[model samples]
Target chain A: MLKSINVPRHDRVPSLIPDTQASMTRQEIANNNWEEALTFVALQRDRSAYAELFSYFAPRLKAFGMKMFGNEQQALEMVQDTMLNVWKKAALFDASRGCASTWIFTIARNVRFDMLRKKQSRKDDVSADDLWLNGEYPEQEADTDASQWDTQLLMEKLAPHFASLPPAQREVMERVYLQEKSHQEVSDELAIPLGTVKSRIRLALDRLREALDGARN
Target chain B: MAHAIKFHPGMSLLEQHAEGSLSADVALAVAAHIDLCPHCQQLSRDITADLACQLTQQPVKTNTTDWQHMLNDIMAQPQLSKQAAATQAQLSAQAAEPIIVNQREFVVPRALQRLAANHGKWLHLGGIATAKLPAGNDYHVSLLYISKDTEVPQHTHLGLEMTLVLAGKIVDENGEYKAGDLLINSPDDTHTPRTMADEDCLCLSVLSAPLKFKKGLTRLLNPLQQFFY
Candidate 1:
């Protein structure tokens, strides 16, 4: 089931990529083909591709877990569980349907959901995968007509609009998505009202949507 | 005949659902609604894709933990073959059991299938029946069936009350609800929910607290609450 990959690991070291969106040159952004890397891991069982993915995602996931769980041990556990799922569920990834980051993010989110359920000792009859990963309804899958948006182009177009948002809106966006904080938690953390937090998020989404839709038109 | 779905979860709720930040019990209602409503499904997909776009752009803090060892350990584990994954998907699809109520069969959304399979025995009172689906502790999740022309007593919620219509039609003071309509009621809202004279109804109900029946006999209110809870 596995074949060796010829791609060299040194050609795509994730560590060399800069941290900020502004600092990332076009070459770096263009080279970020996590979707293709995942295909290699799936079809070729390419350890080098997997390692490159790990280098790019693990620290970010660690930061994500720390923000969500507020401890190092649980964060590390999350990284391990998420990465393991990435390896095991690689065959399920479809590049045409979605990007690698979104697919990986969903896996990470489901891992966190399961961990939360286990910590609460809740009955495991219904799982996050059942609720999130499966088709919303069995018949609905047959009628799915559109492929996902071209993610690389969307990302490139969205970065400037995202950066230009008001500081409060940008901060709320980061806390909600990156930190995975609930709106209520963000309200409490930022010392703002819940309504304010919600409105800011709404406005931020509107601006980003307009930017993308503009490009499409 | 299928009725066009009119009521849907608000955009904020849809966004929260895509983020996986909503509690499981609440998220179940949204997911099931998305099953029946194509509009929300598309909106949810867009929101999730946008989230992915934003998430990828977030700056990462450098951490020095030995993720190398963790990666090596993960690499050592056996990857699931495509055949095995396909088999699992097939098993789940085949395992979906139709929910039966009052000699009538109702097909629930995929999200509720597993928990609905293990639901408790139906408890009947008057023309209404409810069966508890074991899910979260803080909320009461159940399948509620109301026979034709039956009217539930007027009640106000103490916390949150979310109802997702699965089959047939129901009408309240506000408007008519057909299949795939999700009604979210907070503490301040009070209304009587009833079925049409010619149609029966089935709903997925989630309650944060027991109902407080209004405008009923003082001695009979507790039993009325018990009927639904």
Candidate 2:
């Protein structure tokens, strides 16, 4: 017999994003073209636009790293590495290929991967970027729609849909994606079977996929 | 491209890849598979977009002074010119020459090209060849080549084994796998994989643990295990 456990309501609540702040952020995000900000930083070496991006992404990246590292100092280091890469590789950011948020998220993910490998003393000839962000693959020719990759718009539409998910499903999603825990780790932590964790994840993904497609259509 | 890919990494694996939660070596197999399977490529992009939305939504505890300090340092760094970036990409592309084994040259997936270029010398056995790639400590990553009309000894996995076909076809007891197909075998699975009589095959294999040959001569088993691991 499996025992039921109470899941913490951390970070996945719809009420956390109050409507007033959501509207304000939406207006600000609409007026500001993050893609253009990246372009300006690339072409003209614009410091203001760079600063704007830093103010927006740094805190979130710090939060992202915190789950992986569990230490504020190491999390800060991840933020530094990721932001520096964004600055140096700004010219490589192609808006047609992906949105600004997706691009930065890739950079952050790669940096964190490298950091973990380094800590493990795993000397790998294949870098994280080589695996995750290969350049030789054919350009994703289909679905070049700009709106599909818009981060802020998706976030706005996704907030309530994500919040409406059952608490059990939401807990699995947070553990797997936000906390960077593997399915096996989630299973062990929750005292559930491995198959159960995978099923919950699949079901949660199904619901989120439906919600996203509904919003898209 | 001769046959439609019949196998792929599971949905949970793809989701883990998008989350960047899977270990580097396991994620490599998924990345290479996605390079050939456009359907999965699209799925990966959608998942990534969703991940980005969720990630950026976390309410951050802002330390204004610290953020300002880091921002100043990052802003002071010089940015790469578009031309320089393009040149860098071109140079890396040029470096990834085709992989050659047993008098055959096979173009591996884009995700595998860089690491494959650095693969160790190919070691030959009866009708198979294996070249080790630099990978994480927990997994043994290599390029496995099967010559025409060859059969690997029957074995059961001690742990997970992931194989992605880069050229030609392979058949086990369960099914036939063609190029772009990803085969995942757990410890419970036991089978003998072989190549066709006239067609050779090449694969990217990531093994979490060594294979335990079940049906071969006991004396040959140790060497065979040594050969693979």
Candidate 3:
């Protein structure tokens, strides 16, 4: 059945993935069994292995989607699509090119933004160069202490910080990001005005973004 | 000058963005933030210098042989048909030149512009024109030059659309996006885009799917999308 038709398992089959039970952090996951895991996913129609892969990246992918779509629900959808591709394209994962996290993150990132590009229909704007630039490259690198482990450690260290935030601010963030609510949705959920939700989320995001950045330094 | 939202892009993101290693979505958001804050731009450059120095420390893995070979495999493998290649070429083209906020020519990396320009003659899609590149996939690379006060009609989308502002500013319900801003719209999101009058705006956009027109006679032209894409 595998070779009767010359179709690569990568294409034409989007399988149902079970939940991943891997106990390792992203780095551990990267160092151990990542390549083998990819090989397994690539060759056989394995559901359990794909699930473990999805479990690790899904939350982070959702977080990224939240940032991009500005809402949690949409972010969830984005992560879903990203993980789906990851499950199917596990065969394409190459450790030499980049770490599994970087590869998966790149895919998730592209998928999230791809949706954004679709949202803004490509028509009728005379000079688009104004609002969007094709060439917005940053020459800057993640110049943290190279002697230390990957920056992922820093982000993990910052995870507990969510508990330290002002309850009000954290609530706003949770509603908007964790819960995937819109500004309006968050407000309604909390019985607060829309502006309050917007201000709280904005202030919370600013603080979090700054604090996280500072921690890396 | 019109109450531009001053965005304070943090140091870490600036570092990652300048590194060109951040995920593209984060990069786009960070780009939007950078567009609003010149302070971030200066800092990003400083960080860029720091990153270049730090790069000296990143040694090739001991076991790794030629890194280029792995990259060659990805590059050598074919993606989608004409749709994917053309699309990637268009993206690579826009990425070639970093969109200078106020420059006439697209300020991209030399490598990218060479690729996009390598594609056949561009198809002018009234307002912003497009060219179906020789690359794979349903890639539609286009340019938009909006004279002051022009409003691009409201429209929906099918697949994915990526826009890179090459000049001026365009405002949708989302917010006023200035030069060097990347405004991405998720699928099914619709908005009326208006370009302020006085200054002509230039932009480059990549549309993955055919657009779904919501109003007016423009819908009639939907079937004949080759010219418009």
- Model 2, stretches more than 4 Å misplaced? A1-27, A30-32, A122-124, A134-217, B89-92, B216-219
The candidate scoring highest on TM-score is 1
Which parts of model 3 are misplaced by more than 4 Å? A1-207, A210-217, B1-112, B132-139
lDDT of 1 by residue, B40-80 (tens): 67567656655655555567775568776677677766677
| Model 3, span A1-217: residue lDDT tens | 6443333334433333332343435435533555566555556645445545554455555555555568867876676666665654555565454335545554554565556555655332111122223333444343232224333553465446767665776877666555667788775666444434544544444456566665221
Writing each residue's lDDT as its tens digit, candidate 2 over A112-137 gives: 87788788785645567666653424
**A-chain TM-score of every model:** 0.53, 0.53, 0.46
Query: Could you give the TM-score of chain B for each candidate, in order?
Result: 0.94, 0.93, 0.53
What is the lDDT of every predicted structure here? Answer: 0.74, 0.74, 0.50
- What is the DockQ of the complex in model 2? 0.20
- Candidate 3 residue lDDT tens string, B133-177: 333234555555555677766777675555555456777887766
